[model samples]
Target: MDDVSWKTAVESRLDFLQRENLDLKAALKNILRENENIRSEFEAMKNILRKHVQDTDEKCNRNMKKSANKEIHTSVEDEFGIDPERDGQRVARIVPPSTSTISSIAFYSYLSKNSGPITAHHTLVYDVSHINRGNGYNKNDGIFIAPVSGVYVFHFSVCIGGSAYASFEILVNGEVIGAVNEESHTGMGYREGSNLVVTFANSGDHVFIRTQRSTIGYVFSNDMCKTSFSGWFLTN
Candidate 1:
């Protein structure tokens, strides 16, 4: 072969190889662009998912804090004389006697006065009154005072002769608040007493007990105050 033919063949082969290299470089660039786009899309999706998870966690934490705060408030209100069932309002309170013993001179008495505007005072006497047999003794003398504004439970009891029958009742503002009946004796009369409970109106109410049957024996000392009927209050 001559020098001119050899030179032409070499140039043609070089041109074909250069074109193949150029095509390979273009394909590689396109693949790299597609890979970069896929990576960017994955990063964006991950950021969105992270943001949603963080938001959900924040919402749950807020709800839990609110519930805990409400429970704490309710407990505090109840401890401070506030009725949780009554929208955090103060209710009535019943104060019982320090001692629950009957003295020789047993008597329970209270003055009739409104405790709404004026502060009322009450006193009880534990006295034993002697009564003649076959003659009826009426020693129904006592006073009840309201301390706070709310419903109250009044309890009363009494004993008479060998057979004990008592009339226990409750009063609100000097009015009958519950059923009053003679409690008949079943077993040992001297040992047992009549028990009763009644609901009284809030504030300014009075309660007392009277003997329904005549007593041949002296008014004996019993729990409440003494020989006569006794009454007290308790808040419901």
Candidate 2:
């Protein structure tokens, strides 16, 4: 072959090889870009799966806590048979001693170990006196109500004239439970204190003290009129 023809053939072959190399590089770049996109998609799927698992675990934990609380409440009710969620009943009250003349007295309600703790959610105070005497004996002066179901302790006291006999009856829901009666002393008159305990099934039960005579006098004090309860429910 002639040198010029051979040289021309060699140049044509070199040009063809360069074009093929350019095409191959472009194809490889596209493959790399596609691989990067696939990897990003896989990472996104992994993140979503992790979030789903965490949410599912949290939901299960919440359900378990709720079930446990329900079981505990049910067991307590079954054993005690007393449901504070329902009706309320009065459990205790302080009754002032009976007096013949008009006098001021006080009553106190206290918390006991058998009773539950006193909370804001439960508690109520009724008329201090069921029937207040304008200048004489008052019947409406010393009454208290239970705020919740529990055991309660009550204390009450009264003072009468030196020469007169002082007598007081403690009543729970209008029923007589205790009494304090004594002859008056020359200096102190008649001062008597009484303590009574009662268990209320629930809440809203009434407790009061009534004077049997008019000459008997009574006085009520803040220290004498207090109510406290417990947090634990009693069971058989």
Candidate 3:
């Protein structure tokens, strides 16, 4: 071979190799750019997911706190009989019966004024002539609200005067528990009627005497103090 031809062939081979190397370098640069873009996108997505999780946790915590506060407020109200809306200081309380033979009582001696047509299953108001041991009785509305769950004995007595008619019912809440009816037909002497009830009651239950029937009647407590209502806790 001639020297000039050999030199031309070697220079051509060198040019081809150099072009291939440049091409590889350009491809590597493009791959590196693509990797950088992917890293930026991955970081953004991770931040978004982390923010979502944080927000969800915070919302759940707030809801749980609200439920706990509401439960605590309700418990306080039930235990103390505290109506937050009312203005006056709470003087009245529900005294739980003690563990004893005669632990609780709701006995009132007599009514000074004759109060009736105490009809239609109405709660009676009585004068606080006497109360023994403990008091859960409201003299304003003659209802005994129980402070503890127990069995109790309740009694009511009345002497219907002349020209008078009377009937009594012992009630635990709205249910009729006991009854007694008497009428003075002669309009001359007093007629006596009484009702006794042994009942089971839960805390916050109401027990009271109501007049089912009354006609031109007077429940007298004058000299003998015949009209009376009494209750005592029998079992815990």
Best by TM-score: 3
Q: Report lDDT (CA) for all predictions.
A: 0.47, 0.47, 0.74
TM-score of each: 0.38, 0.35, 0.53
Per-residue lDDT of 82-170 in model 3, one digit per residue for the tens? 64435534434455424453464556545666665565656667666577456677777777888777788888987777777877788
| lDDT minimum window of 10 residues, candidate 3 | 88-97
Instruction: Write candidate 2's Cα lDDT for 93-166 as tens digits.
Output: 23322232222222323321121222321222223333322222222343454444445444444434345453
**Candidate 2 to native Cα RMSD, angstroms:** 15.1
Stronger candidate by TM-score (1 vs 2): 1
Q: How far is candidate 1 from the true structure (C-alpha RMSD, Å)?
A: 13.8
Which pairs of residues have clashing backbones in candidate 1? 105-126, 105-127, 106-125, 106-126, 106-127, 107-125, 107-126, 107-127, 110-143, 173-205
Sort the candidates on lDDT, descending order. 3, 2, 1
Instruction: Please estimate how well model 1 matches the true structure, expressed as its whole-model Cα lDDT.
Output: 0.47
Per-model RMSD to reference: 13.8, 15.1, 13.9
Q: Candidate 2, after superposition: displacement of residue 208 in Å?
A: 2.4
Candidates 1 and 3: which is better by TM-score?
3
Q: On a 0 to 100 scale, what is the lDDT of residue 43 in model 3?
A: 99
